[model samples]
Target chain A: MATERTRVMGLFDTEGQTASAIRGLRNDGYTLERVHGPIPSHVVADALALPKSRVGWFTLAGGITGFFCGFLLAAFTATRWHLIVGGKPIVALVPFVIVGFEFTILFAVFGNVLGLISQARLPRFGPVTPYDPRLTGHKFGVLASCETARKNDLFRFLEAKGAEIKADEGGQP
Target chain B: MTETALTYQTVDDTVLATLRPPEKSYWIAVALLFAGILMGAGCWLYQILTGIGVGGQNNPVHWGTYLINFVFWVGIAHSGTLISAILHLFRAGWRNPIARAAETMTVFAVCTAGLYPFVHLGRVWMVYYMLPIPSQRTLWPNFTSPLMFDVVAISTYLTVSSLFWYTGMLPDLAIIRDRAKGTRRKIFAILSLGWTGEFEQWRHYTRGYLFFAALATPLVISVHSVVSWDFALGVVPGWHTTIFAPYFVAGAIHSGLAMVITLMIPLRKIFHYEQIITIGVLEMVAKTIVFTGLIVGFAYGTEVFIAWYSHNIVEMETFRWRAFGDYALEYWIMVVCNTVIPLLFLFKGVRTHLKWLFVISIFVNIGMWYERFVIIIGSVAHDFIPHTWGLYRPSLVEFGIMIGSFCLFFFLFVLFVKHLPSVSMTEIKEALPTGGGHGN
Candidate 1:
């Protein structure tokens, strides 16, 4: 195994405290490895300044692909065998639009799901850092990674912002 | 308690506890549902061995109980999307507790509904011929056929809804993984996709959820409309109406809302989620039921009025037969159960009273099933030619399959509640006072 990276986690009960704590950590040149909360909050997100997710573009791309594919498939199959029933035209736009619309939804949803997994970088191999499970329930947790020499400084930094620090010394429980 | 009063920890503890291994009653229910599934499977196998002739399907009445059950199940699946996706978009706060179960119901109901077309096929093995793929035989299913549209629409609905359900559950599953031990922890770890509630993950997850909801909203409307066109595109007097699309969509949501209520009541009791799935939630669902029931009522009345005004002999005769025909008893019962009984929900008392609401929901489900039956069997039994008019009755085999389908639906739901968080943990926590208001 690689040498363990020192990690210190702080649990805060309020979103405002967590936000200020995150800002404090960032201002001091300490990067926040991760922040966990019971819910997604705009206050926290704004504090962290998260990058915009590109899922909508994925959906748009999937929809366009689906639209043309649906129309072409319908058109191609209609003309493939060339069934001359009552001498009607081979490619009918009106009826085929239904298929196109259904596929738009189908593939757009597919793209959205795929975009989530890819963008979130999901199905990760293991826990990314030391995390408190209570953050998922009612509390806000912030994990800060640093050198063992700077661990004491990080602890004082978190405590000043009204947070309870969990000193997970060796990075592993 | 109002959402504003609860803390995040309280919501987390309450919702996560439901994932525990259920009690003896759950096992007993599972066993019963398993038996029903087995019985259904046995009946299906018997049909396969003997032939499709075992069911009550023949010449003019070839579409029988299987199709009726299919439409009913599909309709029952609609409310999941209605509650989860549509309400989410509209930012309905009360939907927080009920959304998970409703979305789960959507997937399983669609699964149950998807089985019927195969069961109706005389040669079940050759059912794959319906696929658009090419085979050794140069045969391709006609995309123009409504049956083909149904296949694509239903499959898409299933895929998208399942994805939506899985996406919402990721955070909850991670919490379970953290709390669990041994084999259970390992399983949830894999299922949770190593979710850590990292800020980036949350960012992408919310975006994906919104887009999923947007995609699913249209699907909820289109899937049932496609199912309706399976009948509407036909030349049959009653089946060919233009209003059938919206009419079917309304009926689908109405029936689906009833099913959600039916499932939620027992679940809330069993899981001790009374605080979360409060009477207030049930009331909201009940009010929607009344609204949808009125739409369905309007559709019913419109159909009758159109039949009277069209002066088309076939349409007029079919309408007359529906009221006083051989299946008139079912028609009247459908009217009473669907249109009249739902009106009781307009009163706050009946809507909030658990026992009365549960009873009314069951009746609504039965009425909705009967409505499909009346629409399907009634029109086919009495068509354009009086001489060819026929009466159809279901055999024990058909009855077995229908019972089996209900068993299958409940069974999947039971399994879901046992394994996953039945209510959304993240959402409920977001609805708490400490968090922001109803974090839509």
Candidate 2:
């Protein structure tokens, strides 16, 4: 069945009010689109049932790659031209460890950044409609897509939890 | 209102006020800094035209004021990452008010420090030779060189710190975007990359921030250690010591803490951020300085004590020259400024007294610079061979260039506070006793 999903955004003055409203909506089987606020919230995440982030895997992968790259680069350059100073070995890993450590961090940071952009769909262009500027300040915003027929029911439920309805319009799921 | 009483609105208003167009004194200061830059640049040009000899880097004292300035500036860059990254990992709430300022210092100090290598290299254009790129004969830069570690570590430090600083500022930039109008609004919106504070975005952001802090913590310690290795790997009597790594790291953080106190005091007074960056916070920074200061002092004593106890004639002679020779005055100044002076902060009266703290911080800055001078020049000037030893003093050209570096640092900082919110609004808001605290 092709049921319409309309966009709705609600603003709450306090974190307590937003947490409860989101929790209530979730318990009633409504899937939330996203919540916007000035800060991250563990309470809201719990309510939304989001999984743990996968950014660490990316960082770990990048770190391993960075270390190997640093080592190989040094080893390659070192063997390409053999010049021994003070009778020391040309391809020593002890000195390369510093290079490896530096690269490990450098790449980990890069991977972490890439994970953020990819996982979060960042650099989002165009205005995300129904957004209030106050959401960046003290206000907490709850965005959801609801069945067009029950928009009023969602509104009443949110208003019951002390939310200010900022937007109620048709939008894609 | 107290910190707990602060609402998001007041925090935004307070930080945003610092961004407003400034008084005449600001323009005057900016103009003076610009002139100082020009003078420094002019002197650098003079050096380039007249050959490197004008800087007074001679046979024994080949490493002169330029190396000292480089190490000093790099050391200045340390505590910023220590406070921002390490404290974030530890969840020390005290770092909240001043972390933004400190992180900014790291970026600018690195930028300033990066310049000296070029200045020191009379043939500045040959800098690529220091990189890993293959030369005409396809010789890669020797990775075993401590200088190689410096190249990689410092560039890495600059890149990571910049990324960390910007990522933390994203939400705060969004706050400004909403509050702004016209062109400013459009500019901030783009800078913020259209951040709307979605929960998913925040989730990824917080996790990424944790990862950055984690990566940066080790990088900070490693960078200074690498810098110390630049000297430690050498066979110079004073430079080559196993203690050099930890000793340099402690002194770096020590000088860096004093610099934070120096910058933040006037910043608070001028920007009226006393409410946000309270004197209590400054005292906490001072308290940290006490710990780092003691480490620095202990390192100084250990150096001399080890020199005497080791009974290595060269090391012993180096110490004797450092404390009682031609450069003894510089050594005493270093001890007095870095060690004895910071001890004053142990007293509450001195720590809380703004004027006293500022004056002491200035002396510490001077003292730390001289400590570098005493270490580099003192050892190099009077090394093993008696006939090759000679005293080297900095020419006026070197002093001019040094003055320019300081002006460049302050100039960047002054411009920074004006353009961006010196205090992170979102972080401050998160630190409030409100729910949904992200621990930014």
Candidate 3:
């Protein structure tokens, strides 16, 4: 039996304050719905305990694929025509390395970008829930959904930690 | 906002103000650039109707101005990545304000450079032959060819640079989105991909940006090396050299940094971003010029030394002819501009003085263009057989096209400054404190 939960938001002024509130939430076993800020901050990252991104796996996979693809494309195409220059072999392995280098980078870039967008769940349309534009400007923000009965406790919990609680956000009481 | 009063709000207000409705001067600039574009298009069309000879690339000097413009523009595109990606990897804070403009310069410069090869083709319609697609005749492009390497390298450079630029812009676009109204807001909404600065977004975005920087560092170096191979692979006397790769890379960065200074000085004044772009940042860039300039000068001396040291008569003749021949004026201009004048950056007063940096940068720009001109046409003009030796002077068509390319670059640049926040608003805000903060 699940109870309806109230969505509450907290706005913080300083990086120190943001970290403090997030730490308080963790100590009390309250999960943060989201933390938003104007820029990336290590303090907030540490507070959330986010893992190092596995995006490199994507880049590694892409590089490996690109190297083989580039080498094969050169080898297969060169075989189609018995082209040789200055007694150089038709299947010139040395020359093919240049193609491999370029493709490895290109595919790696593609993979990195794809991994970013896919992992971030980006291109999210409409307004982000519990959104505050200032979070994109000066402020740091934290949002949490909790049991309706625990709403006041969460607000008091955030306020005690120096966070300013947003009132009547989108007509929520 | 003054440098003494920097805050998060002012960062947004100052940069986004460029997006305010255009001024009379702005339109005048746009009109002038448009006229230049039209002049170039007319010349290009005339050449198309007339034939490749109209480019005035006579025999022996067949590379001509188009190839010079090709390499020149490609060289200009390099420093942007060096600044945006390399500096980021090194965690240089001074790169903050300038990186946005540098990255944008790369995308457009590459765009401008990419057109030259097609323009050089004489028959631009057959340009698809450069693609790697399966031909109707079953002939694929040569993977072994340096030109094909160029096709791959440059297109990849363009793609990577653009993605890097756009990825960095995501949070800034969201800033614009938050501040806009109605239709403009909707457009930014889509462009921003609904970014709300969530930890998840930042996590992936930062990591991806890191990899983009790491990957782009090598790509930028390789792109120009492939361009150098366009000459180095050939057995032509002056064109064949092991040093061309590093020499060209240094020269490319030299011109690229100069262009950055050339464009940014005026941009800083216009946007009233003295606080954001600060003299310290400019000095940092100028100091880099001293290092790059020294390498360029050393390469010049080393080239002469290498020619004499090798005892290769053909190569020796090429060097001798370049220094004392009919095109000696162009040769000296390259030496002075690319080498001598940039040496001024060795002094702190010159490096910090905006006007000095700007003037010297213009000279470097000229010198770099002549540098390519000297290397490409000068070398070819007097290669193996004296009987085939010939000189090139760009015809009206070539001159018009070159002028148009400059105008095209400036035109795209003007549009970029006007439409987008010329500085990174989010990055600037990251530097803000509870009070006034110093900008990077």
**Number of the predicted model whose DockQ against the real structure is largest:** 3
The sequence of per-residue lDDT tens digits that candidate 1 reaches over residues B42-107 is 998899999999999887898999999999999999999999999999999899899999999999
Scored against the true structure, residue B218 in model 3 reaches a CA lDDT of 94
- Model 1 segments beyond 4 Å from truth? A1-7, A145-153, A168-173, B1-5, B435-440
- Superposition TM-score, candidate 2 onto the true structure: 0.96
Error of 2 at B90 (Å): 0.6
Q: How do the residues A1-173 of candidate 1 rate in per-residue lDDT, one tens digit apiece?
A: 56445788898878888899899899997868888876788789999999899988898899898888887877777776777668767787766787888889989988898888899897786545466655555668898877777878988999999888876643211
Candidate 3: pairs in clash: none
When 1 and 2 are scored with DockQ, the better candidate is 2
True-vs-predicted CA distance for residue B162, candidate 1, Å: 0.7
Q: Tell me the DockQ of each model, to 2 decimals.
A: 0.50, 0.58, 0.58
Winner on DockQ (2 vs 3): 3
What is the TM-score (0 to 1) of candidate 1?
Answer: 0.95
Cα lDDT tens digits for candidate 2, B1-440: 65565677778888988888898999999999999999999999998888888898999888898999999988988999988999999998888889999999999999999999999999887888887776786768889899999999999999999999998889988888888888898889889888888888888889989999999999999999999999999999999899999999988898898899899999999898878888888888888888887888999999999999999999999999899999999999999998898889989999999998899988988899998999899988999999999999999999999999999999999999999988988777767775533221
Window of ten residues with lowest summed lDDT in model 2 chain B: B431-440
